[model samples]
Target: MTSTLALDGIKAKQQKTWASGDYGAVAALIHPMAELLVQSADLSYGARVLDVAAGTGNASLAAARCGCDVLATDYVPALLDRATDRAMAERLPLSIQEADAEALPFGDGEFDAVLSVVGVMFAPHQEVAAAELARVCRPGGTVALANWAPDGFIGGLFKTIGRHVPPPPGISPPPLWGSPDRLRELLGGSFELTITPRDFVFRFASAAGLADFFKEHYGPTLKAFEALGDNGKALYDDIVALADSSNVATDGTLKVPSRYVEVVGIRR
Candidate 1:
């Protein structure tokens, strides 16, 4: 297939993957990470904030709670529904919309800050997505991101999954966002960049429990298992093995630490 067709096919599959499962359940566990990202952004009260690929609105809600005027957007409508519900429940005045990160539905320089927490890194076209993130922010505005590092637990998990079912060729790995050098290359000329390493700890009853949780709530994991058919058990076993190896908990439970990079870019 042509490169363009390959990209189109991959993006379609990604969209479907994200839409397949109850991501909100998994996203809810990372609210602390969202809060940290907003803190790093140092958002001004009443600032206009845009959360791109805002699955279930964790960062959006964090920004809103900080008193910024927030718009939470994602390509998945079902995820937006969950975001809307969360915003309403929290009594935060935030807008939820459907938008693609590569082609954001907003005017240039429209927002004071743009935030993506484990979000935009998954965009099929990383360069276009990075450009759009820069384009939407006003001059001197901040674009903050939290992306999983390639050597982190989550990254290793993806690598393990890839061993079972490899990703499409010609597409960059999402973990590139976690590399300081890659982030600088992607955003440096248009924005001044800052990178900080951080870790998030995941606790589960056991390695098996962690695998089960992802299989049930994380779309990518769920879809991978579905695609594997009878081979899914083998993949799950690999996941459990990796989880056990990464687990830090002493009492037989799982507590895996995943490192991520916190990126801040100021529009030039």
Candidate 2:
């Protein structure tokens, strides 16, 4: 592992970024990916599962619904609160913990499966986060992920945001988690990786609606606009234009397909 000095700063900023807005609303749209990840992991009934960086308990809820014992964690307290509410309403047994992906507070080999759906990839130190995921799972257990492909709509959205307000230097792009080559480099020594490409379509009334919804609900998007201040409108315009160009709906309603890669890694 590299020195933690540089990552310390990035980690702090990352926490604030995620905690800035009501991410639960934005996360709701991607909950389906969580079900897919749970299925890909092949979790068995009553298995002990850990959902790291578990935004709004998407994967955690899915696993719990399958009769698995699940512990969902996130650094942002608000997100965990939302997850807790969801679990209560569904009468599902889920334990919510406040934890950082790069430094999980759990015993080694403590879980039957570890999962992250578009979650852990945002950690400031990618390798450290990946190592933590592997460390927490028992030997022969599974680690499953649903990450946005760099060539996809969501990935392109981030790139557009970067043009407006560049991210800190020396941090790996979160979308790298979607790349099979990067996964091999990050996780090969500890696990055997299988990647499957998939698409998740975002339906909205229009391009403007999509952009407005994200600006109001997605933490990173909300924060990006805040940081832009006077230039926020310009950023919003770019996002809407991008969405408009990518809309595939023939009936006028927006249906934007975002490509992502589902990763299943069996511990070596």
Could you give candidate 2's per-residue lDDT for residues 1-268 as a string of tens digits?
4458878877877788888777888788899999988988889999999999998999999999999999999998888999999999999999999999988999999999999999999998888899999999999999999999898999999999999999887878899888889988988889998989999999999999999999988878898999989889999999999999889999989999998999999998
What's the lDDT for all of these models?
0.92, 0.92
What TM-score against the true fold does each predicted structure earn? 0.98, 0.97
Residue-level lDDT of model 1, residues 1-268, one tens digit each, is 3377788788889989999978988898878999999998899999999999999999999999999999999998999999999999989999988998989989999999999999999998899999999999999999999999998988998898899989888778899889888898899988998899999999999999999999998998999999999879999999999999998999977899999999888999
- How many steric clashes between backbone atoms does each model show? 0, 0
Cα deviation of 227, candidate 2, in Å: 1.0
Runs off by more than 4 Å, candidate 2: 1-3
- For model 1, what is the alpha-carbon lDDT of residue 17? 96
